[model samples]
Target: MISKKAIQIFSVGIIAPLTLQSCQQNAVTNSGDADTLTGRLVITGSSTVAPLVSEIGKQFEGENPNVRIDVQTGGSSRGISDVRNGIADIGMVSRGITPEDDDLSFHSIAQDGVGIIIHQDNPVDSLSDEQVKQIFTGEISNWQEVGGEDAPITVVNKAEGRSTLELFLDYFALSNSQIKPSVVIGDNQQGIKTVEGNLFAIGYVSIGTAEFSVSNNVPIKLLPLNGVMANGDNVANGSFPLSRPLNLVTNGEEDLLTQAFINYSQSAEVHDLIKKQDFVPLSR
Candidate 1:
């Protein structure tokens, strides 16, 4: 569901709509010959935002033959640093830019929420926010304490530099140094797999990513936070309590190709693609 705000931005062509209005412009832009616009645009950032942005890049490349968009994932922090240092043409950040972020420009691409996950066999369907915080902080170390098995609780945490880790920590008002993780993972699937393979393990990741994997029999369940369901529908409807913006950041001036790609990402054309990847599209 694209937001009405995003639709207005896209309609007015904040950066110019990807849909050129005239057959003549299309003829020139897609002349069937090698486009004069040839450049490699590198985007590195959040694994959460990577899949959707990669899809956008692929679609954009198909329309403009000579443009090559390379998308990579490390974490949102890496994306911020890489773009600021000119190591990347664009940074895919799953979180908002801060006031101290040197005033870089960003385009909101989508929205996602951080969610807790546990093995499917675990009977505990949800935990209160305080309980979640205590679990990560090592204050609650046994399943029985949380109405589960008598086994010890295995905590899976995200590694440093990952935005997932950043948000999880912030949500619980915790510091990285305070968490006691039995295992640390980098991406959503890594965290999910860790929880899936360990019946007593509890971890967190993107709700959209986790839902997609669960539908495909990933053997995991999303834990409710503050008694609210963690799903795309809840997130889009603003009923989900925990959520974050997905963005693409550029340090300064962008080349024509880079700007065009950004416009394409923000356009209405990729709304379905964003949904296909289990993320909420910007408002239409």
Candidate 2:
């Protein structure tokens, strides 16, 4: 006759092996194909879309430890050219490419609002589309002429290859004429800084950078276009004329990693992330 202690010990010994085996199986299952993906993905494009793409790259890399994503911000045209020439696997753009970009395939990932921002100290609250057109085209040279203080208007513009510059020129039908040489040309961040530091300066920037300007207490205000405020809701409803689709262009032949990135971008998990980055999700 076996004692109770002996029987208990026998039961424990039987269960422990099964429990260990179960855990080992789970570990193997959980680790399935996680190491199968390994390579570098190069993404380049609009400085306007850089922050959002950077965030996506960070999160995606965290999940797939074997992959590396490199992100660079060259102006939008450069991005399109890079992808077309196979310099990058992904190219982000704030504006759409033309038929000349036929060799490259584009995926619209998000939407962005372009707003004319002024120093907060400036009392001008709004401007009609015509007024904005005139201001950027150098037709309006004085703040007082537009109901602001008695100061000369300083127009800050993005560099020649930038998407913002192209958008502004197209929106105002100034494509045939070169941007006034007198306009101060700067990169995305520089444009924001210039407007913030100069009380009479006005510039155009994506909503993301504009939000950063506000957060940094740059004393800047986003002016309405055509009397319609440039906010997420207005942009979504097409009420904001300056709103444009942001894109991720590739060679169009889908690969595992490219598909993975696209899937991630279209996922619900990334929708809020897109919004937090101050852009509207394409899904919405």
Candidate 3:
């Protein structure tokens, strides 16, 4: 639950907008009263960050009754583009902001890990980093080669423009052209579902999303990455090798309402919401 101070921080001293700006054009609606904090924010970006942000948005709206938040998912790239192009009030980006995005303000709300996942029914508990690379590269097409039951491996890869895909390819030292995938997924849930339905399928997704699925009795396992467990605790402590920040990005200077939401999202008030999504909240 959010604290009173946290809610007040976003609700207090917010005057209604008079004129439409680039970010405010048609996206925000205001009540007639100047004292009321009434508006709508359109947030778009990483599918990985969408669910968590959606939950946070709901809580935020609950606190500030007059405000509305809309969260949409495409990929991390879309988030960056939408914010930069002023199509969205905020963008949910899962990866670290690169030098190319110097003009954008990135507010990191939490941490998550990218990890390899396979059906729990598979006997193979873990794979060496090299083995993972080989599997995706079609060098090891059969699960038997990795000590699993005899079956053709179903390779699940992330679609292009996804932060998960970029992180995965970088850590494994593989290129997109090198991957021979049976399926390409757009988001973490889709990847998790694909692996869940196919016993021989192997995919990668956010460790936080995978953990949340596992907790709900999903038939999937998050394999250790180079002997390190793929979980939020490991990411929070910096022990996980393939972790990335969950950020809310803004194109330029933010409106007062936008700034308030950003501050609340990063504050300790939303730690439980972050944990509920299996993500590691920023340290206070």
RMSD of each: 9.4, 16.3, 7.5
Segments of candidate 1 deviating more than 4 angstroms:
1-36
How many angstroms is residue 272 displaced in model 3 relative to the true structure, after the best TM-score fit?
Answer: 0.6
Return whichever of 1 and 2 wins on lDDT: 1
TM-score of model number 3: 0.88
Top TM-score hit: 3
Q: How many clashes does each candidate structure show, in the order listed?
A: 5, 1, 0
Assess the local accuracy of residue 85 in candidate 1 as a C-alpha lDDT between 0 and 100: 69
lDDT of each: 0.80, 0.72, 0.84
Residue-level lDDT for 156 in candidate 2: 81
Residue-level lDDT tens digits of model 2 in 4-117: 221111111112121111111111112356445555566766878877877787788777776666666667876777676666677788887787778878788888888888
> For residues 48-157, what per-residue lDDT tens digits would candidate 1 score against the true structure?
88888877877887776666666667778877877876777788898877786766898898999989999999999889888988988999999899899999999999
Error of 3 at 139 (Å): 0.9
Per-candidate TM equals 0.86, 0.84, 0.88
Work out candidate 3's RMSD over C-alphas.
7.5
